[model samples]
Target: MIIKIAEIEEEVVFSGIICADRFKSDYENVDFFGPVEYSLKIGRSDKRLSVKGHVQCSLNLLCARCLESFRYEIDSDIDLQLLPREMAPTDIDLELERDELDVRYYDQDEIDLTELIEEEVILNIPMRAICKEDCKGLCEKCGGNKNLNECKCESGRDTRMAQLLRSYLEEEGDGHGGSQEKAIKVKKG
Candidate 1:
């Protein structure tokens, strides 16, 4: 996965497929389902290097809402500029130019493609993943998946509200006969 800068004369285009198993150790949170196929263009001018590429892969992600595992496909483009550490700006207070956002410094004569691919994949992942819109999550009362089954629990009332409601009903019925039983039936209904 290491790309040697010395191998490239001026510019070179390389294409390859990295197996899903190769990234398992590096990206433990992601479950890669397919190979990452990529095409990279590497260009070197004096001490500066530029890398541009396209990567494609499939992943298994868990939905944040329903907690179900689902497949997601990713096709992303990457562009980076590499400068020698010595060539980087020395001023700490200087504002970074717009073009410098994507710039990176390399201390060695090689680039690690594995780390690059891992970064790309991780960045493309959604901040909050859902299996589908309007996904019904698990029922809080019985721990039943609301998307798959219906539960008889009172799904709306909070525990604190229900307790306060019960106490209020008991107090209201203390001055009246048989009103507590009627109020209980009404609440259930």
Candidate 2:
């Protein structure tokens, strides 16, 4: 939804649902399970705008570890200072001050809230989604889901460390090391 700057004289409260079609193309991989619900209070002072409210939605996403489909919920608070794009400095490597962290740039006399709502949902999604805290993940050998059942795959311990330890023990022969001599003898015999 696009809100025109001219429409807001002082402050306006808007509560509505944004359909999924508005941002379906924005994220190809994301599948929104429902429409985005928003309750925003937009205030205008000169050309500057302040949008404060909350947005929430549910999404169907794949778990990073188990690769299973899971429902991810997003409930984000919106407290943004909207400024005209022309007001932004042209410096490419400029660092933003502490107060400018929540500032967002807008183009023309309208604010495209569709983009803002989509951004809030995307930012809340976890980088690595886990279905549960104790998810066993998939087995390496037979490619089976370990959460369902245990696999009969043999234990595959790396032998390089064992070989290195054996050589180190052989070099320390009979020199204040009884355990090392026993280990060397066990390996050699």
Candidate 3:
């Protein structure tokens, strides 16, 4: 969607493209349908190419533990000062950088909106997807989903330090009063 600065006054949906987004795995259906809402503003110097807007989309993702799919929303704000590719100013203060391409550039009279909108959607995907806040997930011992039904596997959740200390006491048998001091030291440590 190219928003020309000279010919825009009201807020309008100039460009809306629903792409496959295969480069990023946000949607599994090969094509995640969405839109990008943008508008143009004439700058102080009467520049012909300045645009700002927001992007939003939603899709389903499968949880790793439970193997169930759920909904995920992709929403982000975008504010970019569009500039002609040849007129883009070179950043003189970029550390460890030379005369290299910095960001997405546009032609003399038009702008490409696909790249920026896709970037926002790709960055919004979470690292881990869960069905619910209190998802029980699968049983550790047996391969079974704990959300739907209970498992016969023994409880292996041994995160208690006190229980481990008691087991160590059973092994040491309080020899010469050294174990008690060691236990206190361990606790303090």
TM-score winner among the candidates?
A: 2
In terms of lDDT, the best-performing candidate is 2
lDDT of 2 by residue, 84-104 (tens): 888876665452651466888
lDDT by residue (tens digit), candidate 3, 20-133 = 444435445222444433332334234433345566665566665576666555555555554556655566654213233223456656554565566655655544545564
Ranking by TM-score: 2, 1, 3
Lowest summed-lDDT stretch of 10 residues in model 1?
180-189
35-71: candidate 1 lDDT, tens digit per residue? 8888888899977888899887877766655677777
In candidate 2, the residue pairs with backbone N, CA or C atoms under 3 Å apart (3 or more residues apart, or in different chains) clash, namely none
The TM-scores of all predictions, comma-separated, are 0.70, 0.71, 0.55
97: Cα error in model 3, Å:
12
lDDT score of model 1?
A: 0.69
RMSD of each: 15.6, 15.5, 14.7
lDDT of each: 0.69, 0.70, 0.50
* Local lDDT at 176 for model 3: 41
User: How many steric clashes between backbone atoms does each model show?
Assistant: 0, 0, 0
* lDDT of predicted model 3: 0.50
Candidate with more favorable, higher lDDT: 2 or 3:
2
